[model samples]
Target: MTALGFLYPGHSAEDDYPRIEQLLGSDIRLPLVHTDIGEDAHRVDALLEMGSAARLAAGVEELRLSGAEAVVWACTSGSFVYGWQGAHDQVRSLARTAGLPASSTSFAFAHAARELGVRRVAIGATYPDDVAALFAAFLKDAGVEVVAVRGSGIITAAEVATWDEEQVLALARAADHPEAEAVLLPDTALHTASHIQALEAALGKPVLTANQVTVWEALRLADRRVNAPRLGTLFTKEPLVQVH
Candidate 1:
């Protein structure tokens, strides 16, 4: 079994990993390290905007201490709010901190989209329009076009976590455009892995959610190839290329 580590901001392990485990079947082991970055709303935006290298480094080190082969910074806004260059630097800093392969949820989205050969994407976010704009720009820099975007104007991470699957699917279906080849729902706090298959069935296209891409990217880094159809089309479909 391949072991992968997830660094979450402020969510419980019980709520996060079950879907991933279900998607990967009963074979893979995912150990998560939860950091309480979301408790203080005042510092949340600052931490995300200015780049919390020290805190992020601490989180990565904790995951490494827990025997993680590879670590992923699981917060989307925490990484992408820094813009393209800042995001790249954050990943490099994480790699240095953990002394292992490191990636962020934002980076995973880009890599997943690129690997799947998806050119145009519709984005659904639970953030303000400005924050969503930053995410869209980051994807554009990665060669994916943002055909459409919708934001839920949600502020708190806890509120986002409380969002049910029906709400998320409704938002995704409403946000999707006919021209878009894929729909990206990028917020790690939201429970997206559980809703991916349903969203794909509704949209009739691939749906890349935050946790899905994060897990997939971590597995890719660890040299684990999973073909769990219940997860969604991405995993069931052949990888666009072999990383090795």
Candidate 2:
């Protein structure tokens, strides 16, 4: 099996990873290790602490033992709150420690957008508006345009985990913009595996969620892809020719 390691923060909505693994099929494995999340707070200082090298490093041995071909930092807010360069540095450090390819959900969104051949996207964030704006800025640095951003102002990952399907759909709809090519729900703590199809159908466009893109990013780092149409448009076919 091609195993992908995931370093998750605290405990909320991580079950989505297993659900996605099942959907992707038996040839793949998603081994997850929970990293210490000092504070579940959505503030930048707290997030910076959460995704620290020390915390991330604490989980690499477990993943390496699981035979992971690639690793991913599955917390979106934790990664993006560090800004683009910091996030890149974070992943680089994790990769070196794990002795494998590594990425995070933040970069996953940027690459996933490119895979869909989409330049403009709208963000539906569970973070407070200030934290959400940081995500918008991170995406801009990656060359993806943020046409619109709608934040729920939720301060904690634990709170986001309690959101139901209706709320998930609402956020995507609220974040949608006429000029946007896709909608992004950027929070790893939110449960989105089961709602991807529904979210896209309701929006009449592609909806990329945190957990969805995290798995996809792991696959990309492993240099592999699989067709799982039920997961949404991003997994329906081979990677699209990237738009300039």
Candidate 3:
């Protein structure tokens, strides 16, 4: 069985992983482990200061006990606020601790964007503008083009977690630009999984939300991939990477 271990922050939206599992075929397994490594604050420094390899280490142990084949640090801001190299270090440390393939939602966004052949994207963020700008810069450093970005200034993860489909769709629309090939929502706290196809249909383009790409990247790191049509273009497309 291909079991993916997701190490999410304590304050993340609870349904994202479960929604992904429900969307995937019966052949895949998703097991989640949480760590008290995040704060309610959504500021740049606050988000950056939230998680660490040490904080995530115990989560790896829990995932290992659950028979997880791979591990992912599933918080976007927590991973990206450290910049590109820092994000790399975060996942690398997790892999060392877990003795398994590892990745983070930040890198997952870049990988998933490349997988979809999206050079330019618009960001629909739940963070304040300053925090959203960090994500846009993070994507730029990762070699993806940031066509446009808009933030809602949501101050806390707890508040973001409570947002419904309508609010999310509005963010997606607000962030879209004519130059963008897709609209990206980069927050693990935002519940974007259940409304992925709906958002895509509304936008008439791809929407690569944090939780969606996190699951996809975890599968890829584990050397497994699932093609769930309802997941939108990211799932339907044939990426350059080998899916075993």
TM-score of each: 0.93, 0.98, 0.96
Off by over 4 Å in 3: 241-244
lDDT of 1 by residue, 1-244 (tens): 6678877777622365767886687567788877657343313365473347777765676677677889888878888888899899988988888889988889999988877889999999988788888899999988889999998888777788888889989889988999999999988878877777788999999999888888889988898889877678878878786543
Candidate 1 runs further than 4 Å off = 12-14, 38-44, 47-51, 242-244
What are the RMSD figures for all models against the true structure? Answer: 2.2, 1.4, 1.6
Error of 2 at 37 (Å): 0.3
RMSD of 3: 1.6
Q: Model 2 residue 155 lDDT?
A: 92
Candidate 2: regions farther than 4 A off: 242-244
Please, what are the lDDT tens digits per residue for candidate 3 over residues 29-76?
Answer: 888887876557887766766767678886777799889888888889
lDDT winner: 2
As a whole number from 0 to 100, the lDDT of residue 103 in candidate 2 is 94
Candidate 2 lDDT over residue span 1-244, tens digit each: 7999999999999999999998987599999999999988999899999999999999999999999999999988889988999999999999999999999999999999999889999999998999999999999999999999998989989999999999999889988999999999999999999999999899899999999999999999988879998899999857676422
User: Residue-pair clashes per candidate, as listed?
Assistant: 0, 0, 0
Show the colliding residue pairs in model 2.
none
Model 3 clash count equals 0
TM-score head-to-head 1 vs 3, winner: 3
Best-first order by TM-score: 2, 3, 1
